[model samples]
Target chain A: MSDAPGVLTHAAVMTGRSLRISRRNLDAMITAMMLPIMLMLIFVYFFGGAIETGTAYDSYVMYVVPGVLLLCAGFGSATTAVAVSEDMKGGIIDRLRSLDVGGAPVLAGHVVASTVRNLVSTTLVFGVALLIGFRPAASLGGWLAVAGVLLAYIVALSWISAAIGLLARTPEAAGGFTFFMSFLPYPSSAFVPVDSMPGWLHGFADHQPITPAIEALRGLLLAQPVGNAPWIALAWAAGILAVAIGLSGVLFRIRTA
Target chain B: MPETMIEAHGLTKSYGKPSDPVRVLDGLGLQVPRGEVFALLGPNGAGKTTTVRILATLTTADSGTARVAGFDVVADRHRVRRAISLTGQFAAVDATQTGEENLRMTARLTGLSRSHAKHRAAELLERFGLTEAARRQVRTYSGGMRRRLDLAAGLVGSPEPGVFFLDEPTTGLDPRSRRELWQVVRDLADGGATVLLTTQYLEEADRLADHIAVLNGGRAVAEGSPETLKARFPGHRLDLVLTGREAYLRLAARAVHHSPGTLTLGLPTDGTAAHARALLDEIDPHRTDVERFSVHSASLDDVFLALTGETAEEAAGETTGETTEPTEEPTHV
Candidate 1:
């Protein structure tokens, strides 16, 4: 095994490098920066007038908050997969493979960029929602809890996306995979209430990772009780993280192998 | 005799249909002494790059034993990785980031401290004549500049022992750029780095490599120093540059062989100055005076062509008739 300190330090530095590259690419920044604000505006100005809620219309975005952040994470992660594929297409990955770098750190660089991008996008979306008269009525502790949940989820998904990006045959395949992820945000309760749906749909949604995650975020963002959602969310996040990391390890093996 | 830094014995790779596998390297063996530039020459698809990949620990061999800096490639891969750097056909530097940033990123990955990374990047950029382009995105750089930047990035880590695997590093380059890169390669070798270079250009290998291996059909057709390879050929010829088409054809009819448009006539000779003069006198003075000429002997091209009994391109065709490698199990170098 490699020295633990060395591995962590190298991984952190690689992540920083990826973050800098992501920052310099204006298209990436614009995509992340605009997404949160656009979603907040669309739900608040247009949808707010028409939809009736048992509670305040402004409170609807708080429920939508978890879903929007998931969408944000998916969007950010997909682009990183494309970026890694592009770099690998023409001897770039070959060159990296030749260097004195362990494969893990190289993977770390791309995944970090995805996580950081989603974080920025989530934060921005929440900020915009606040500006548009959306009130959480939640304490700072609650908001922090929601942020922590989002961060954990982001880390898990980013690794899976990075592996996909690295191992895909072509760049177009990488881009096309984004559509699959876009659809994933649908099955989760990111938009409509799960209770409003049919029995089967509600059952499936209730059991899904997105459901517990959204419930927790909704609890924190709207000052409702977290109840069982926090435990469920933690479990879901941990499971997905373990699976994704293992999948990434396998993909990495196939790639270098 | 130089100490050996790399050694591969009876290495081979098989890919394709499980029942009918294609062997890419059939019992290949190689040794590169410490601090020597070794060239692996072959046409496209001759498995030169594949051999380099195996040596760099990027891919595994089916049946063989190999070591880099005395570390087993499969079992002690981290140690192997710590000793080498790779620069592929195109520059590996990130296009979105500035050149300096790319180098610094590599430095950081290789385990330099943050400040040390910055310092190393600056030093390499300057050494590679990229100081002016250091702050610019690599996407905007010219091909030559990008290649230079790529070289700089490879050196950012200052890997111990400096075993570099360069695959066709000078493809599609202008003569001036190619020469400049050659100088860079020479400089690296001079500084005591062990370099493994693969190339299609015969001249580049002859000019740079201390020892050359000519690969054909995934095996070594000829392996020796450039001088030794040339000596093995043991044949010299005189080249007469004719002035007029009619003159060239008339001379060609009497002479051995001639190129169609170039008006150059070849006469097999024993490398004697007198034989060249006799061939010159054989030409009609009115029709053509030698524009300029040289009596040259066998090159790596001639040695490769003669020893392989087939051109490198032919070997590639044969490889295709065999099976492509199957992508099933993970095979680390």
Candidate 2:
């Protein structure tokens, strides 16, 4: 037989497979894209007036848009867990492994697809926020930084979800395992300010990774001082990316074994 | 290449708690020559799947060694993998993708160029009678169609004769589908690919395999050609179907074998009409208790029963004490 395919080629082909599956799952795609948008509208129109931000911004959409973007990542990445879990539960994993395909390519495919799905929904959320009178005063550099930070977070979260998918026994259980990730944003700076939350809640809201990520996005978009929030956000993303990638490798071996 | 396309020796694997492990494979050994179809016949939890998995490089045996296509399964796994295709018990095709897509993706993963993969996919789809359903999602296909597609997927990268592992390839298929798959398997071996298949059906092994291994308690109790195995239980037998259950019970002591389900009693004979008549007369002189009687030679079923001390059907209905391989969960289809 001809030389076996390289790892990169396998990853690319698997990525194509994942993307095709994502495209055909219209119900899931629509839910992933629309959930953040619906949440954005509810906060901006329904809950925006009742809540007050300590910032100088006039419209609540400006402060809430970044948090919704992070929410979009959470919801989009959870699908990665279900997709990976489905592959593991089926006979396809054994088929692929028998064909000489390694776990890295198979898991990478899901993470990359998750990132692409999150990006689309993030852009859609941004557009909907703009339509609802949200305006940003950031320069080009700030926009690039925001994109970099969001991409890092989305990719990192997707890997974490992939690891969870490997750990779970079924697709439903994998989806359930990701619930805490989707809810992380809510307890952080996604909605109201940390100070506005109860005293006991401030510890988690201030110290968690989601709060720094949202803080970095809010500061960048509003042209305010971000201090070390962007670096902290990127560090969190990098740390999670490392841990998740390593954990996914271990989990993949364990599950497949 | 070695004449033996697949070989395993003293293979052992166990699962469960460390203190109380359940041995799935205990000193199992197999040798399949080139271009031959070898069948591992056993009931559930007989370690047939485990043996195939070890040889296919999906799972490693806890002890011993296996070589597939002249490469060690554990050390040279990539080489072994490149030289083998495994069609697992479950149909492994992606439900969301079309049949064509599933085949093409497998082709791509196996190192085919994009155009070549497409051409190969279409060729296999046509060959497997799935061309009409090529573009339809696999989720919409019937079980038989899915199995054909799954088999087609495994063949995508195999242009040359190589080791092929089919784990219960026709387990849940209808009779027609099973026969069709048998022909396909025969064609595969006829074309020079060494095939190692596992099955619970004695007839499947008898009909298809050049050599059959009867596995029980994680070891092969008997191994030979169908005819050779049948020769072990040589001689014809008079099979008598009694008129009533009471009559069957009355003559049950005189019979060599009796089946409660059919009220049939089997009495050994010398394959002579006179001997068959004499035995029948001695058992039921008036012929009022006898429904019918027929003289038949021993079959693989009889050989299996003789070797394992249990009818194949009975063995299938219950789990053996030494085997605890977890039953596969039902696929979502």
Candidate 3:
């Protein structure tokens, strides 16, 4: 009999499979990338001038783009919950598990593909933001740092969505659970400054991971003082990733057991 | 003497709380010889799926040990997975992927090289008679095609000298598709693969399996060759064609099946000439109690009902075609 395939080989094969699946479902891809662009347009044209940003709508677009990009990545990552839930419901999961393949590759395929998908949507939104008069004042290193932070945030949130997907009993339930994370940015530093929020909401907005992530992105892209937001954001992303990976492992075992 | 390829000892499984657990398998055991098809025959809630799942290494049993293809299901799970293929009640093929892609992915996952995997996928598509539609997504495939694709996918890991677990593989197919799948299953067994088929139809077990095990209430209530199991019950059955509904109603106490459409009452009996005469004499006191009667030998349907205390009508209803037993001694009344 043939020996079990290596983890990297399994991951590659499964990642190829996931990518093909995503390619086939172009509507989902468009929806993921377009939702953020739509939100950016609405907020910039309708609500940007009223917000107390102390800048013109053109400059406000730049300020809001980071928050919108974070929201885009978070929302895009949540879409993976539907795919993962469907995988759990389908017979293919059991079929693959029955094979002599490493367990990590299955989840790895979804996580990696999800990260890629989020990055694509984030890039599309960034492009759209630029088309609408958004500009950045950061150096090349700052742009790289921004890219690094965005990638880290996407990976961490994708894992969390994957965990929620595995834990949910149905695809609808998974969608419902993961969709709530998109709103997390609204209460944080994504849409408005934490200090400008109402008293009760300010505490949560100031401390949550999304706030630090938004602050880091703002600092990186707008040439603002980042202070310790970059470090805090990295720590939060790492912490969530660890917990999500651990939770997903436990959930897989229980569901399969 | 054939060596055993699959062996399970005292397998037990349960779900829910320890204090108020629901037992699905209780001290169940199975043994199958190499290169033979053994069918686990049972109705719903009979632990057939549970046994298959445990032996396939998809689910673990609470107490027992199961070995498939000479490897322990628990300790050597990887080896067992490598040596076995399971096609569950659901087709399990990716609906969004084309049939060819599905097969190729399975092949690659089974450690076949890229070129080998492609070759294997093409071969399987041709073998399953889906080469024309291999490129189309499986969502467009008919039920039979999907099942064939599923069976093809199961063989990606290889079938020769491998163990196959088919759990109710033909549960919802039409007669034509069901017959075609039965032929495929027979082909698998003839190719030297040890096949463990779980099905609810008695005729499926009788036609496809060399040995049959009747599972009930979390255990094998009876296990033997089809002929041996059939021999355990009464030899013959008395079929009485009634004249009217009233006649069938009167004979309902002694009838195992009362079909209003055919106006026939099936009664269990010994195949002896004397028993036939005695039974007819006892029922003929009313003069018009029965219309016509004939005696025929018992089939596996009778065996399953007798062994598991289940109704034969349920089994007969599930079957697509009639199972005709030979007449040992023709006696009419």
lDDT of each: 0.74, 0.88, 0.84
lDDT per residue for candidate 1 within B1-333, as digits (tens), equals: 227888899988878887998778888899999999999988776778778778777888888989888888889876777777888876687888899888887777776777987988999998889899899998898887888888887776645458888889899888888998999999999998999999986779889999999887688888999888765554565666777777766666654335645676655666777876676676654534667665655454445545765463453354432111112231211
Q: List the lowest-lDDT window of 10 residues for candidate 2 chain B.
A: B324-333
- For residues B1-333, write the lDDT of model 2, one tens digit per residue: 899999999999999899999999999998999999999988788899999999999889999999998999999998888888889998899999999999999999999999989999999999899999999999999888888899989888865687899999999999888988998898888889999999987779888999999887788999999788656654456777889999988987866566767777777776777887787788888879888877756544455567876555474465442111113221211
Off by over 4 Å in 2: B232-255, B259-264, B267-289, B292-305, B310-333
- Binned by DockQ into CAPRI classes (incorrect, acceptable, medium, high), candidate 1 is medium
Candidate 1, residue B173: Cα displacement in angstroms equals 2.3
TM per candidate: 0.83, 0.89, 0.88
* Regions more than 4 Å wrong, model 1: A1-5, A46-63, A87-97, A198-200, B159-161, B231-278, B283-305, B310-333
Residue pairs with clashing backbones, model 1: A257-B331, B15-B325, B16-B326
> Please, what are the lDDT tens digits per residue for candidate 2 over residues A88-193?
9988999999888999999999899889888888898888888888899899999999999999999999999999999999999999999999999998988898
| DockQ value of candidate 2 | 0.77
Q: Write candidate 3's Cα lDDT for A1-257 as tens digits.
A: 56667989899898888888888888988888888899899988888777776543246787798899998988888878888888888777878888866556888888899898888888889999989998888889899889889999999999999899999999999989987888888998676667787899877888988999998998888888899988899999999999999999899888888
Better of 2 and 3 by lDDT: 2
TM-score of structure candidate 1:
0.83
In model 3, which runs have C-alpha deviations exceeding 4 angstroms? Answer: A55-58, B232-238, B241-305, B309-333
